[model samples]
Target: MINTIVIDTEDMDVKPSAVILSIGGFAFDVTNTSETQTAILQVARDPELALYSAQAFYGLVDTFEQLMMGRSVSSETQQWWRAQGEEAHEALVGERQNLATQLLHLSGWISQHREARIFFRGTDFDGSILEHAYRMCGVECPWRYNGKRDVRTYIDAMTRGIRGYVKDHQPCFAMTKHCALHDAMNDAEQMTLAHQINSEMLAA
Candidate 1:
């Protein structure tokens, strides 16, 4: 069971900050804050599970990037990008299976070890970029074009009944007017902003 669901976005955009993926007793928190700044958080009975999640998540991003770029990924290419992608997919599975596996493990761990629920919060770009990348990579999300499982529900929950905020917040940062929307921020900085916004929300 998912105990916590935290969505992060800029005050000006509706992009998702993070998507929390939990497994038997672990959580792999995936975030797309920047081109190179991706994150995976693992929480399980065994600490080693975190390593597996990290490797798998990184492999997924790498494979997805290659597919999105449309580089000649065939084995005939001197770079063998296609073969490398195939190898990356194998590595991702060898490291971790589908999203469900990670969630189930986290649920089990919470039940047996009394671990706290996992939550993710970040900028709106997180969701938008992720959805775009997923689509580009041919991965199907059980959500709408905006990447929210339910658009109306997502708006109400994220905006807290602030109609104007809900109305203006876009699914991707690129669509927003904020100058920082597309400005590259390192992973640590992005994480800091995410935490800052989450804290502000809690304080309110």
Candidate 2:
């Protein structure tokens, strides 16, 4: 009965600290991992947004419209993602959702699924981008303070047991597609797995 929201976010740039370029998220139960709901919101781009390097654009943004419309570009992060591999680029842009609409939609979704706790892989980075996005949209965030859960910390504590179980039992997480949607869904799935494994270990 535990509903968990797994989320991932991509940044627009590095130096000034980038704004959120895109977001992928999904909700699933820790006990019933098979049933999941997902959301992807790619921010609309600024018309004057300049590329750090022409090649950097190759991976991150799918179109001019999908780019973060109000925020400026990040040269350092652009060069960094350029070096990261093919799939990494897809994270910046996917299905387009205006930042304002995306914020409203997420707020509504969270409200509907009030029992679901938000879980992000990178607490600091993801939290910052999302909070900034809300501020940019002039919207109050949906969740109460401390509503976000730390997947990294929970997973870190279960690392040794999870590693042994995976090695011996061959449990696998969904692929890290580098797409925001897929990554977020993966986090949801992994959260369920983590809860399952930890409970089993403790019971044993």
Candidate 3:
């Protein structure tokens, strides 16, 4: 329907704002680097687009409880945790500090780009996780309430409520399914293409 109708008004400005982010979930695994992609340096180099993945660290008690809760995890992973002993606790503490540093860096970026819009594929999931991470780190989320944007909602608006169409059409690339960086990049690319198409429609 978006393709069929051309609304005559001010041209829709689809040039994506400054940055796109995909925060990883609450779960933390020291062995899994896929969930943590700290892009502070990248953000410094390119102000046009920024992507980051935030990870949370839980205490050993919580970790074991989580292990017990996650029955589907492989035996090897369980054994790995068991073998960690005091080293695992130390690692988690280090990770928590790293998370705090990352969040502070993010806050600085957001402060610098005061008007930038933060886009997320699933805001409720990613956004909440990021916010919680901030709280856990004792840092305030820097972006404003209205600055939080959702990719699905944007796509639906741009495509006349077309559902699941964009998911299948990821631009020429292989996404490492659960990898935070890959997922964020994929979503950002989809939003960019959708914005381009929507802009063309408005011009037409």
The reply for model 1, stretches above 4 Å from the true place, is 6-47, 51-60, 63-120, 145-204
Which regions in candidate 2 have their CA more than 4 angstroms from the true location?
Answer: 14-17, 34-72, 88-95, 158-176
Kindly provide the TM-score of model 2 when superposed on the true structure, using C-alpha atoms. 0.69
What does each candidate score in C-alpha RMSD?
13.5, 9.1, 14.6
Q: Looking at model 1, report the run of 10 residues with the lowest lDDT sum.
A: 175-184
Cα TM-score per model: 0.28, 0.69, 0.51
Q: Roughly what TM-score does model 3 have, to 2 decimal places?
A: 0.51
Clashes of each: 21, 6, 0
Best-to-worst ranking by TM-score: 2, 3, 1
**What lDDT is reached at residue 91 by model 1?**
29
Question: Candidate 1 on 15-84: residue-level lDDT in tens?
Answer: 3222221111122222222321222222212334343442221211223333335422333433432334
Query: Which whole-number lDDT from 0 to 100 does residue 149 have in model 1?
Result: 32
Off by over 4 Å in 3: 1-97, 164-168
lDDT of 3 by residue, 105-140 (tens): 556544443434566665554565556556654688
